[model samples]
Target: MKWLWRSIASLALGLGALGVVLPGLPTTPFLLLAAWAGARGWPQMEQRLLRHPKYGPVIIDWRERRAVPRKAKWMASALMLSSLVSIWLLPAPMLLRWFLTLFLPCVALWLWSRPNS
Candidate 1:
């Protein structure tokens, strides 16, 4: 059971890392989950996550101060805007478009509102 959790956490973090390259996929939230899961399932993985260059500081900031860097805030905001624009332009269902538009911007806002560290 513990190993299962560790695998799941590692998978989530790996997917999150992949999200870094794939647009519209989230990074921080998944990393947060990975950190949470690592705490319970794999201390070593957690430590590795903390030591990661791209994600480590963000995780640490979130853990210590619930903060994100200012650059991250701007990047998140821009990505959300781009996503919203793509949703509008895409020939998707109205419900799907509305849902993403409403939900993603709110997420961006919440993330942006956090204090930058």
Candidate 2:
């Protein structure tokens, strides 16, 4: 069980790291997941994440207040819009593009609706 949890935490951390560079990838949620899993299964990993210079502050903000930073919100919205535009430009199946079109906008809307911290 511990090993399984550790694996999941590692995976979440990997995704979170990827999110750092990729617009709309959402680093916070995955970092939170990594933190939760590490706390349960690997304290050292949790501590490492907490100590990380870049990722740590965002997690701290979320922990201290259920607040999403204004910059993050705007970046996410922009990315989602860009992705939606890319989807439209691509010659993918209409259904798939439509699904991405609908999904990304809703996500952006929800992110925009969150209170600024």
Candidate 3:
């Protein structure tokens, strides 16, 4: 069980690291997941993540307030809007496109509704 938690933590941390350099790939959520899992099996890793200079504050803010920074909300919105436009332009099935079309706005709305950290 500890190993399983550690593995999840490692995987999520890797993805979160990748998200730092990859556009539209969110970093905070995966890091949050990593920290959560780490707390169960790897306290050291969790501490390291929490102490990280760049991401630590945001993670702490989220844990304490369930807040989302206003800048992140805008960036997420812009990315989702671009993705929606790209989906519409793609030669894909209407159903999938429609699903994303409906989904992205709901995500944006939910993101926007969060308190700014």
- Which one is best on TM-score? 3
lDDT of 1 at 1: 82
Query: What TM-score against the true fold does each predicted structure earn?
Result: 0.83, 0.81, 0.94
Residues 36-62, candidate 2: write the lDDT tens digits. 899889999988888998777777777
**Alpha-carbon RMSD of each model:** 2.0, 2.2, 1.0
Instruction: Give each model's clash number.
Output: 0, 0, 0
- Which RMSD does model 3 reach against the true structure? 1.0
Question: lDDT (0-100) at residue 102 of candidate 3?
Answer: 95
- Residue 89 shift from truth in candidate 3, angstroms: 0.3
How does residue 87 of candidate 3 score in lDDT?
Answer: 89
Candidate 3 lDDT by residue in tens digits, 45-102: 9999999998888889989998988888888899999999998998989998999999
The TM-score of candidate 1 is 0.83
Worst 10 residues of 1 by lDDT: 71-80
Candidate 1 off by > 4 Å = none
Q: How many Å off is the CA of 19 in candidate 1?
A: 2.9
lDDT of 1 by residue, 6-66 (tens): 9889889888988889976778879988988999989898999899998899899999999
Sorted on lDDT, best first, the list reads 3, 1, 2
